[model samples]
Target: MNPLLRLLVLALVLPAAACSTLSAQQRDRAIAIAAAARAPAVDCGQPDRCAEPSPLRALAGEAFAASAAAPDGAPHHYALLLDEGGDALLARVNLIRSATRRIDLQTYIFDTDDSARLVLDELLAAARRGVRVRLLIDQLSAIADLQILAALSGAHQNLELRIYNPTFNLAKPNYLHYAASVVCCFRRFNQRMHNKLLVVDEAVGIAGGRNYQDDYYDWDAQFKFRDRDVLVAGPEVRTMERNFAAYWDDRRSVPVERLNDVARRLLADGVPAMPPARPAHPRRVEALSQAASDPETVRTQLVARAMPVAAVEYLADLPDKHHGDSALEDGVGAAGLAGLLAGAQEEVLLQTPYLVLSDHALEIFRGLRGREAPPQVRVSTNSLAATDNPIVYALTYKYKRRHVRELGFDLFEYKPFPADPPVDPALGGWWPGQAPADAPDPEVARSELPGGSLGGSRGSAGEAQVAAKLRTETRPSLLRTSAPANRPLPVTGAGPRMGLHAKSMVIDRRIAVVGTHNFDPRSETYNTEAAVVIDDPAFARALAASIEGDIAPGNSWVVAPRAKPPVLSGLNYSVGKVLERSPILDLWPWRYATNYEFQPGPECPRPLPRRDPEFHRCYAPVGDFPEVSLGPKSILTRMLTAFGAGLVPIL
Candidate 1:
């Protein structure tokens, strides 16, 4: 039997033995606790409440109504949100403040961070103004604070919060209980609502990869995600509203009042109501409020001045997609994405944080490559040094070479910190060709070598020699930057470490897709995903420009045909590569390894000072390597990964 399989078998059997040790009294107490945690269902009546008119409609609805009319005959209006963090936040807040009738929000993760609080405060404020608010969040990530959510919902009659596919046990949820719950309810626990969208007044919406968190918006001091989102106003907003209603009306979506009667009672017993924190960025709030005052100006500035309307299609998986239902019922699935890719005539650009290609995706790639006139295919994903999830990186690393060779796809791995100077806004920030001359070309092999030769398969003596040769090569050329010698360094210090979290695709410079779906098994089979596919050349080019900035040499590493050789300068890289090939050991503290890979070493250059404290760092360039580490918390994380690896197919 496989060692990993044997270990998993032992785990399943041993857990039962441990449970057998519990006395009858202890078992009863546990059952009582779980019973108390499970809340009774509350019926909110029909979904028609969401369509009611609001007082603000008279003030702010005219612009959206006009935009949706498309006097010029365009299908939709879109503005690419490239503000890193603040811009996206402001956009959502502004929409909420401007909304007159209803606001619908659906997200996978609604963190307790400042970003979430800011948005939540705005929602409460909107509700106070008599605008209806409906929020749908996945229960898996939101169950820990049921009392708080219940209190919030109870406080506002106009605002309703629903937890999608909630667990029966919600009180004081710990890791062990979570694991037990998963074991008992494996089917429901494995599936998540991995969708992020916000629609205002059923007239305009914002949808894309960003979640409600500081890191997504560039506010996290330690880490920042290079992400993307789109501001949409037009007929597509109505489609988004319909998607929200489907999830909101699903039987599995339990209202917070219904989730735990005990928690609801506790709230009635006078638990202190916790109001949202004061806005961290007060100026941002002021700006949004000012923009809300003039809906026409906001629309003109966001859409007319910058983005233009074009053909748009909203695509989303059904709330019941986890039930193994047919793709026809879901409306969105891997098949939709595959069909989109198949239609590419000249070029396909993809940006995803994770890239664990499925068999179906691989077959599509193979089909594309087999074509007599194959389009140029390029992919940008998180590098080992930049990925937040190391287990996913390990799996993706195993197939890196195959993706490049078999599919002829250009792959670029993002760098944690690039040393190039801040990009000129006029030239488009982080433009291509900002890295050293020696950076690998995705289309060219280092040598004319066949498969299984040097730089090919693992375990070959020739491959080892090739790795050694690569390690010995001079590093100066690879570290050179595009900045002039006389240019002064940033004064504020290095900015937050950057990672790729955006899920976007631009095909043939005429079609674009932006959403929360990562190109991995989890997204393909386990989680429900959402995105907007725009079929306009102008809109596609705008999105493509933002994606190209992320793939630029200064911001990302081009995956070479040869594996990046282990070097003393990148000790974490050596360890990560070794772990990637190991069976039991690879799971060792994957998160620690991921962190270690991106941690600065002795050779790392000092962060230049910048005048603005929020200014992002422009690092001195460096060579590529596998980023990894063994840290103090690795043991538990590694053990978790070991167990979780068994569920990778479903994950």
Candidate 2:
């Protein structure tokens, strides 16, 4: 045998030979220790203070009351968009602090940064208050200290933690172990739990693209995520609760004690008190914590913004989505979006962090375009300059023709540093005239951006120039070298850049959907995703307005055909279209379309529609990639565009 072939066989066999699950005795010991430890009784005498101060609960009660009185029973929904980083963080904080009965959190990624630790500390406090708390985190991306996981396993009987789909039946697996597992069971190893959900007392639920990380909540100094979430309370919450239960009860969801790493520590040492979470951004955390618990802030800022609407539905794909090849199906997120787009009568708006589309999604667009009265479609996604995964962006870059001409899409790609991002009043924004109460600490108020830029919102022009020249900043990935196509993200800019991570759609200005699905091939085919659909015109319009802000001229770059090269314009487009149709061999440098920038002047104060005759007068072509340089990732992106089309389905 070849030396490499012989080594490959040994490598594949070693993981099975060396690895072990919880033995019979180990399992019995864990059960005994768990049985001996019981959670303390509730000590709280007042329920009101412990109650999360949300007017949505009252709205939900009124909905239920109306349902009982109606001729035909139908439920009502109270929902508000959590588009700002501060607001999303505040919702989670208040939810944890308010739990008197039970709290459940489900997310794909759980880091040990200041933001995640703060949430963990809050959950521990809730458990101490005798509120039952369960935390379900996917194994691949989550990083919990072994001692902490072991201590958490038995610290409070009221608090239970579980890991979903562990590759080696362990909380902490090394790179070699990860590689071996992939070679051994490729499909199962790739199956990740991508749902981001938080349900408090089964009365309120928050769902969207946020994971438990600093960037997701705008706490990261060097980078931040421009994401969105929906705080919902209605009959649909019951469905979310049931879906969480389904995941919790699934055999794939193993208790922390059952994991090899956590179990070993539990057997060696008795349960210890949870270590206090140390915050890197103490001033910011303190300010946010005050806002979350303050009656007036919760009442005025959050409660007042909620809209009471009718017909909200929660949809989730079960863990069986990865059982086998027989499990192949359009996950709920993909199917739900497809179904909603199919019903489009006049207009559709779609936004995602990733731009890669699955085949089913492509088919839906094709059918819609074939219609005699096809609806106008507008898409908002990350530009090469703004995306976390430039590799994925290459696939989108590979098919710009299909997205624009074939589908008739008015596509806008988000910028790395938008002039304005929707920020909470508690935190001032990029532009002036915001409420003056940003970070409480003057130095900290610069908000983690180096050289004192404010909260990664906006930076000096020179600072941005330096950042855009970045060639080697990497994205957050949990894989080793062997992982397919895993490479440092060609982040055009590094420090304090915000990327769009919200997955949402608005249809006909009458219905809206928000959830964790990226609408990319990975979310559509691989991950178990969930979403919320609301059929309320007013709420849909509000969601539409939020998306509108994102696609504004200063915030995004429009994707459109470049000015005809003045000669061979016909041959140029024809040849480019033919090359783009293939997944590979699309090496044409002068493509049909490129990103365009909006130049505002006194004559044109507002943005014009793409089809507007005067559109070209106000917009200037900004090249294929706006803020990017020819770096390694760019080279790889170029290479992938030319020859890597076959890697699309699993991106």
Q: What Cα-based lDDT does every candidate model obtain?
A: 0.58, 0.75
lDDT of 2: 0.75
Query: In lDDT terms, which candidate is top?
Result: 2
In terms of lDDT, the poorest run of 10 residues in model 2 is 428-437
**Steric clashes per prediction:** 21, 1
User: Estimated TM-score per prediction?
Assistant: 0.68, 0.89
lDDT of 2 by residue, 307-326 (tens): 98878988778877766634
lDDT of 1 by residue, 1-651 (tens): 566865665576546434423445543443344344432332234343232332233323444555568678555454455434544665676667766668999987777666677788778777766678898988766634544664564556577778887655342344554555555556677778888899987777788887776667654444556778876766677888998899999887876655443243443453336544666554434544454455553444343334555577788887767665634532354338778887788899999887877666778778889899999898988875566655565456555545665677777787655433122111111211222222222223313222121122112112111111111111111111233211111111133445678899999999989887775777877788888888878888877877776666545665543222334425544555566445455542211111011223464443222222321223322333332233343343344334444445663
| True-structure RMSD for candidate 2 | 4.5
The parts of candidate 2 lying over 4 Å away from their true place are 1-13, 20-22, 34-42, 45-58, 325-334, 425-494, 630-633
TM-score attained by model 1 = 0.68
